[model samples]
Structures are given as C-alpha cells and as structure tokens.
Target: MHLLRPLPQYLVSRYHGWVATSYAENSAWYRRLADDGQRPRAMVISCCDSRVHVTSIFGADSGEFFIHRNIANLVPPYAPDGLQHGTSAAVEYAVTALKVAHLIVVGHTSCGGVAGCHAMCSGQAPELEEKSSFVGRWMDILRPGYERVKDLPADQQVAALEREAVLVSIENLMGFPFVKAAVEGEQLSLHGLVHDIRAGTLEQAEDGGRRWTRV
Candidate 1:
C-alpha cells in the first residue's frame, strides 16, 4: 500500500511557532480547562465548510462553545435503530450529557453540500444517487429542505435551499425526545442562523419563521 505524506515542513514549523507563542502565553487558561473540563453553555452545530467561522464571528474562546461540524450542518431525524450516527451521537452527548443551555444550527451560503443535494435531486449529479454514495445518503437528510425551495428559478434554488437547510435542521433537532423535553422544561433554547458568506452578514429566523431579520 502506498502511504501518504505528512503536512509540509513549513506548516509544521508554523504550528511550532504558535505553540511557543500562543500556547505559552495562554498556558494557564489551557491548563485550567484541562483540569476543570468543559462546561460550555451552548452547543453550535455548523457546516464543515472552513469559512463558517462560528468562533471568530462570535468572538468565542476555546472551551466556551461546544462545536459539532458536519456537511451542510444538518440533523437527521431521531432514530435509535442501532446505526452508526455520528451527528446524532454528538447531539446526544451535548444535550443529555453536557446539559448545554442552548443549541444553535448555523448554515451558510454557497454550501457545496446543499448544491450537491440540489444537483442530485434535480438530476444534475447522478453519481450521488448510487446506493454506495455516502455523501448522497448523508445528504438525504436535506432532501426535504431541497423540496422546500425546489420551485424557485434554477439559479435561485440553491440559496433558498441553504436557508431551508437551517430550518430543516432546527425542525429535526426537535425530533429528539430529550431535546423536546428540555425545551419544554425551559432548560434549552434553539436558534437557526444563516451566514451570508460573501457579504459577511448573518440573518436569523424570527417571529416563528415569519421572517428572517438581519443580525
């Protein structure tokens, strides 16, 4: 078998510099976090896209937010059928174990996952429809979200579906029994936000989805 190479030496050197500077400067805080463990007040589920910047946008420090990132930032319906569900496991841990006070689902514009779902559902990306296609199967969670925006013009559907993805995730998050109970008991709050990647703006779903006001 052919082995892959490690990160370039320049990247490794940069990491070492960061450790000697940033790590050394904040070593006390890092040590305290290790000793006390994490007690984050909110759990943020965002997209795997590198530009989402949940921490930078919120000015959050390490250990302040429990973050879980997945393609297109989706939450599948609650299913305890003994399948390997990574996203579900994260939600279970954050909600049941960590007892986070808030759960936020953040979707962003120009999401490749959302675009692929549009293509697959719209017959533009047939490869994703294959039974062995893991991405298509994982993106099935957003199929309903696609349906919500499929009626728009071809050029406009992707962005609309992006917003729907957030709505769908927020809806699916409630499907978990414990999450529902926690919300009803006033122990947890749910939020849906969409990031405008190019404009550097955020819009929030409000008035029970009647409108999305800029945040």
Candidate 2:
C-alpha cells in the first residue's frame, strides 16, 4: 500500500465529471446493477491495447459484455497445473457461473504484441528471446501462428499473425472442459473477429477461420 500514489489530477477531474454527468444521469440504473449483479450476454477476450475498445465497437452498455484482456489477446492452452492463470479463471467464471451465451476472441490490426511475436520468431528480436522477458514467453503461445504464416511475404506476415492470434485463441478456448461442455450443451458459442483500425472495418472469421468476411 505504501507504494501506491495519489490519483493524477486529470483522471480525478475526469472521474468527478463522470460522476456529475453520466453517473448522476443513470444513478437508478447503476443501483439496479449493483442490486441485481451482472448478467452479461457474452464474454469478450480482447487485447490489452488501449486502442481496442470492446464496448464502443459494439455500442454496448456497461455490464453487457464480460471482458478479459491480455497481451496479444491470446488464450493459452488449457493446463490444469494449479498455477496462477488469470485468463483461465476469467473464462471459467464467465462460462460456468455467469453462463454467457457467446465467447468472442477479438484481435486487431497493427497490434504491437502480434508484431513482437513475429519479430521474436523470425530471429529479429533477440532481446525477446531471453527467458526473463514475460512478453516473450507470452508471445510463445502464438509461435505456432507465426509458423503458419512465416512463408508469406514480409509485409503480409504481421496482419496474418494478428488474425492467427484470434484463431489460435478460439481453438484453445475449446480446450477448457467447461467451455467444451457448454458448447456441446448448446449453451455457448465461439466467435473470432478482427478490427482494421485504419479502415474502421471489423471482419468476422468464417469457414473455421480459413476466410474472413466484413461484419
């Protein structure tokens, strides 16, 4: 606690403004949410990138989507090693307890994490090769993805890898027993999407991620 610092002025001011405006305007709705708890329709696994706004993209209200974010938006294969797995824990809660109807894995264009994975795998980023580099180890989850697209032209590799992140995550999500059971029971559905930042386009994966179509 001693390491914690006071909130910056700008954030404090913005929060106060929200309280005075949005919060005050929807106080009743907020109270209802607190009283009833959350019942989100979907679980969105997205990147930690600040540019990717899950709610804004779908025009969703608060409490409508259960969101979990990590580097590259990657979901590691289901490993029941009794270790700390934040993403797995979130997925378990969302699927088993909350019973969300949809599990969506979203990636985006120009993703730094995806680019780092591309660099690390192509022998271009030695610094990431170190065992101590957390980002490097996390990006290893996407090495199979890099291998799948390594033969492509250099300019096309990163974008392809970004989509691979989404595909790989969707595949891994099925590895979770609860997730699999939910899907088999017709209680859950999986989806993959990619956002093209420059073009303001969102694409959905189709035919088992072999092709993409505009959303």
Candidate 3:
C-alpha cells in the first residue's frame, strides 16, 4: 500500500491541479458545455485499466466522449430484475440522455480479465460457482471467448480471446433497446477497437471482418 501512495496522492493533487488549469484554458468551451449540457458525439465503453485511456487515444476533450468503464469493459445483456447494474445504467444514460452518435467498445491486449478467462479455460483458475467471488462471476462474460480460443498457443490465445470478447460486448450492447433503436435508425454507429498496451498501438475491427487492422 505504501508503494501505491504515489498514485493516489498524484491523482488527487497534481492531477487536480492540471484539471483546474485545463478548465481555465478552455473556459469558454467548458462554460458552453455546462450551459447547453453535454453533447458528446461518442460514448466509449472501456476497461478500468489505467493503461487503457479512451480520451488520450482518441484525442478527445472533456465533453467529446461520454465514457463508461468497468471490469473487462463488458456490457451485459439487459436485465430488469432490479439488480444493481452500473454498466447497463451508464449505457442507458449515454444513449437516451446524451444521445451520442457513436458507441465504441474498446478492448485491450494482455487484459487481466482475459488472462483470468484463459486460466479458467486451462483449468488453472477456480470454477465460477466454487469461487463465490464477484470477480469470478463478472469474468464469466469472457467464458465464451475463452472456450473459442482454448486450443491456440498461449500468446495467440490472449489476442484471439480479447478480440472475440469485443465482439461479444458489441452484441450485448445491441441487446439494449435504446442502443438497438438508435443503431437501426442510423442515429448511432458501433465500433470495436483493441488497444495493444505493450506496443502502444490501436487496431480497429474491420466492418464485417473478424480480424482487426492497425489504426
């Protein structure tokens, strides 16, 4: 915990200082955004990983993209059982309230969730039911991807699963009524992208293609 102190203190202090200066630098734009309300053109669903930053990668400003981050950047199927659904609620707000024109599902290489899924697939991790852990349950979202690429070499397996997981998340995003309607009406577009954290490169999945090409 002592070693982690630098991050928290820097974020609360140095980062806040930077934010304050940025707000002043773009005062007019910030004021307009506040007055007219946020009208971001895109909504980014991405991992909570510190390395996978949507704004930096897309060169977006404060009001440019409404963002949602979660473990593995998943978008689960819509459920109405009154469960505490953070990601789902964010999706609803971004689509219905913000009315963003595009929704980008961003996946990254060497993700822990993807690694965990690979562990589970290889019998290296505990079973979901046996674990009784929130992370284990959440990681179930990647099970299909894990199963799909289980036979590949370890390095390739991670890449394949990560890509497949992005596709699954896109499908899940379409499960929401607001998203489906917006997309079908051509009011919104969906994009799937993978960020290779190690190489500092981004790849966008081609329309109607399973493989992603470097952007």
For model 3, how does the per-residue alpha-carbon lDDT over 99-204 read when each residue is reduced to its tens digit?
A: 8999999999878887777777677886643668787788787777777788888678887988877888888888898899999999999999889998989888
Per-model clash counts, in order, read 0, 0, 0
lDDT tens per residue, model 1, 1-215: 87998999999999999999989999999999999999999999999999999999999988989999999999999999999999999999999999999999999999999999999999999999999999999899999988878888978999889988889898998999999999999999999999999999999999766589999
Clashing pairs in 1: none
TM-score per candidate, in order? 0.95, 0.97, 0.88
Each model's Cα RMSD:
1.4, 1.1, 3.4
Per-residue CA lDDT of candidate 2, range 1-215, in tens? 59999999999999999999989999999999999999999999999999999899999987899999999999999999999999999999999999999999999999999999999999999999999999999999999899999999989999999999999999899999999999999999999999988898999999999999999
What is the lDDT, from 0 to 100, of the residue 103 in candidate 1? 97
Q: List the residue pairs that clash in candidate 2.
A: none
Worst 10-residue lDDT window for candidate 1 reads 204-213
Model 3 per-residue lDDT at 64: 91
As a TM-score, model 3 comes out at: 0.88
